[model samples]
Target: MVQHFNFFYDESEHSRKINHSTIVSENYYDNFITTIVGWQTADEKIVLKKYLDFEEKYSDRKSDGELKSTTLKKRQFKNGFASLNRDNIEFILDLFSIFDDNVLLYFSITSKIEYIINQLFLNYKNNIWEDMDMMRYSIVKAIVMYQPEEIISGMYENTGELVQLLKTFFNKRINVNKTNPKLKEHETLAFTQILILLDDINVKFDINWNYDIAFHGFKKYLIEKDISKYSLFLDREGDDGNTLKAAKQVGLTFVTEVDSKEITGIRMADMLVGIISKLLKSLHEELRYDSIEDGLNKKILGEGWFNLNEQQLFLYKQLTHIICEVNNAWYKSFCGIYSDDFIILVSLLNYISSFDTVNEIKAVDKKMHGEHFNAYVCKELESYFGRMESKLPIDPIPGGKKDYFYNQRGAKVFFNSSKQPLLKINEGCNIFNVLSVGFSNDGNAMITISENKNFLCYRLPKELFEWAMTCVAFANRGDNVFPSKVQFTKNGDRYYADVL
Candidate 1:
């Protein structure tokens, strides 16, 4: 007979419209931090006693028999953990003490805007992360940094409008750069990435996408942890009809819904999730977890933790230590960020854990990386199109129209002709595989250069590739031609070709 462990799950967040302007996910309330506290059947009594003893101590203050993270008065939390009275603080520490080798705890964070972006970009078909994901993640971050508004609005509208809005934005940006030249590198990257991913699919963003990441993490943990069988008892508030279903996806034989206020285990989960959500929200607003060697407490103290109280320091160190202890089993645990703030959160958690994280995360960056990333294409796109990648070019900046603004709209924005020699993907009978760089067919400044079948105009640096593609595309936009899907496999190498 297969033995079963037990899990009590709880969540701390509400459904809200995603705030597009926010960069850091934890800083906003639109996101969620859901937690799972689990243990085997043999230790069930040990688990109940912890909550039992604590409830007995606080019986007079509440008599409710449930310990909530909000046990501290709302205004009191302004002082951090110091806000909790000594007796209640011990209650929290005791609950956390149960999070050991046997008792399991995991935290999952999801951002609303990040969810929408992932959904808008990661449609079932035309998904960019299938095989080659080298630039997919970095590409999304670049988009978020440069065109958060365009993408955000698209989620509320047609997903295809995402493409049109981005085009207008980048077209405007590229035109403006010709004058002022302040376009950031990521903006250029985001431009190319958008163009590359412009598909006909009209996938609409759903509110449900917000819960997918956190739930997916939950499912994966239940599915993979120790290859063990388990029964899940989710908090009543967690029964949004999705959490229970999400947990079931892992094939858990026994998943029942119960009130957290009634069950000791779920109440512990509620308490832990409550504290964790507050911890993340506070830290995100107050600090950046950049240090690799120091615990959160030590790092804060080292950085002149003048705003913090002594009890806050002690409590954080204690809690952070318990959280990091979970990292030891993080492989099956997946106890980290899974949403828009993934890079920042993983880096932060690796930075957040007070103990050595060498064993915690093996390839955090390459977690979602598939075999799809085509380095050659990334390179060619950069070298051929990376305009003004170096120093700001001020020479021969295009001047405003000599004609009146009343005659034409805004100086005709972009030029139909190129003063500078332009490059084109060679589609010739005799020329074969070569990039036609500079000049025209009249051969004034034109030169034919050898090109690869896979990669574009030689190799460009990965960082600059996206930037260059945007430049090349915009530069050649007047021709009304854009490079569509460049797919090659069965026959031989089909190089760069344009679509009308």
Candidate 2:
């Protein structure tokens, strides 16, 4: 008689048994199908033929002998395996159906939906649902259970969150690591195709979704912060020369016509520029001053002057002097005064209009663009100094024409020849005195600046085009040089270059 020994099972042993059973079951299933199916299914036969044809077309027989051998072995294995899987032929069919549906959905969303559907029915008739009927059934069941619209709406509400959930679900069912290259590629392709479809749905529904929402939100924030005030002068309709002139005239009339008593103290500062202009014009017409300084002092310090503190009085005098100088200088240089001077004057008026006796001393003169002067006279005067609501009432001077001079090697200078005097290198030929010059990327284009404030662009010559191209590439990547002085500098005796 033999004695029987009993072995006690632990949790680890139980887990091992379960794991082994799963492995055995999978192996058995694979082997069983291999034994049953005799390979050479009509659909797989076609695929194999196509694969062989592609190999023949692209692969050189002499060079790819090793590759061909390996490919042949794989084909033999695939044929043998397919032959053994007769009972599970339906599985192959099911896989085909699932693939077809996925492709259909992808193309449909891409606006090529009709073509994909037609291909599924006409071209893939035999292969459709041939290998994976269970997968096909499951996918169909999912489609029926959850409508496309519902999925789209859910995705719209929380795209990131839903994509994460889908990834988790696929990982659990597929048992493949998401990080695997093949799996990741498939996921990316599928998700991108689905996203294309989602975009179509969003457009059809007239929903303003996606990245633009954030941009619009930012714009709203800027408006709330009063940045829109700066853009007011940029308004095309109201900022024309005629409109600006009318606005200035109206503003001047409004200020001068209203009696000092009728005008609110807060608003008086707003009208200051117009009132001063009118007062100055009157004085210049009726009582000619021997000098500009005397005329300003007489206007502000004389008997009819409004009450002002020491600081206000000082600012008044300073502003008159500054305005007179700017006006005179602009006329002298440009041959005529532009409406730009009026913009500065208006800013000054707004500043003065807000001045109060209590707060006048704290304000200081602030220059506008180095050309015009502005000052804050009082805390109450701050609002009147609001951005010029009116536009310049003049047609902006059209930009000057550019003249380009190119050297044999593609180095070029651009300048407005009509405005600036050019040095004549020959008869009817001029060389621009360029302030700056450089090559753009690819060496084909040259950019230059001239003394007359003009930019020049020219194409490089053909013979040195390649070297010029390289130079351009290098120049684009080089650090920008700010010209301190326009002169020639010699770093070495042989290497002399212009400093810009």
Candidate 3:
């Protein structure tokens, strides 16, 4: 049977807004979260009952009201959540028990601003409360959803603006190197890459995507795993033609605008992402603690505020209850630049077990010696676990070797002296190969006569050709050898040749 599942996806992020310039070393709260929860279509009836029961017991709030973590953080809900019947730990436990075997969860978490600044260029709108987050998310979604051609076609009108913004940011006068003398090689490369990304699309369309990279990674993972044929019922954000286009791009067969109040699964997904965002914040703070020995453990062991251990313990327990284990729920980070403080601890869950596991199997071969098994796997696991990559260039040295000729950007000048007149091949003597061994092939040679602007091709015997190749190789290796002239013996007569 092609099992039908209903997936509810939502996002949560930190409420506070901080600009790049305003960030202080002491103030640290930056995280964005995307959550997706799914269950079999047949299990909706029981799921509704579980949510209704919990609401009736603990909250005077109706099922239609928003059950966000921020709203739940109010004194009334917090007090009721800590009541004898429904304490904070038991509340999550109860929610977990409702859909134990029938549900699946996945989430991605990263610093939102960090992701924006590094991945997509930040757009400064007057209102900080504008849908900037959603816009950022949409661009990343579009990046992942369509190829460069498709995106250029879909968003053609914006290309000029994008190009202008890039030019202004990089301070480049022109795109081509032949025209502009002061263009940096890396900047040129970046420009070329952007141009390629904006090249060639005949079709034209538009999309308004409210969810960004959080959903980008989630939908991408689904597409990768071949489990994309699900009914995506998101709590209604807004409907636009772009949403449908994006949905079609990601292989989602059906899309439904769900009411957060009506669908308990949708509301639950909202609550879950919110709580996960909070947990991620706590985890990040724990990671940032400078003096902590066991990095990820300091938070779990509760060296700080009330019930911090309980919070960490309950989060794992509830996750375990939902999917039977905290490690089983798929987790990924979509932020372009990730932090290095806790290299292995950014897996949506704050727990250490959320880190990826590697299987190291050693097999002994009869002919294999000391380095045999090491070469087999090539220390793949060690390399993966050792260091995380940065999105920005790490310690880049400016001004590459390619711009040394005439002090302009072009191919590197290997040999730079002067060229001699062209040497013609003799009649009935076939020209064989064209070798490109030149320190400055810009019509120049390190050893030359009379500063002529031409190069000579000498017809050499096979032995002489081998000698020439050896000499070129040595010259390339920085050996101080330059030929002033050449003389070859022909039929017991010496034929002399000069560079001119």
Cα deviation of 301 in candidate 2 (Å)? 4.0
Global lDDT scores for all candidate models: 0.48, 0.27, 0.42
TM-score for candidate 2: 0.17
Give me the candidate number with maximum lDDT: 1
Q: What is the number of residue pairs that collide in model 3? A: 5
lDDT value, candidate 2, whole model: 0.27
Residue 368, candidate 1: Cα error in Å is 34
* lDDT tens digits, residue span 114-222, model 2: 1111222232211222312222222222222222333233334544444344334433423332445463454334434333322322211212211111122223322
- Tens digit of lDDT per residue, candidate 1, span 1-500? 55578888787765534443343343345346777787878888887786678767666655365567667444444434645666757666666666667677767765544555556556432222331132334434334434345555665655556657756765655454444334245544554555565544345656454344555655555533543577778776533566666666655557888887788888777777777666455434343323211111211212222222444445555666666655444332332212333222233333323323323223333322111112322344355234312222112222244321111111111232234223433334223232322222222332233344332222222332343454344434322122333211221333322221
lDDT of 2 at 374: 20
After superposition, the stretches of candidate 3 with alpha carbons farther than 4 Å from their true spots are 14-29, 61-66, 74-86, 119-210, 238-253, 285-302, 305-315, 320-500
* Estimated TM-score for each candidate: 0.54, 0.17, 0.44
RMSD of each: 19.2, 41.7, 20.2
Best by TM-score: 1
Candidate 2 residue runs with Cα over 4 Å from true position: 1-280, 283-300, 308-500
lDDT of model number 3: 0.42
Q: Rank the candidates by lDDT, best first.
A: 1, 3, 2
Sorted on TM-score, best first, the list reads 1, 3, 2
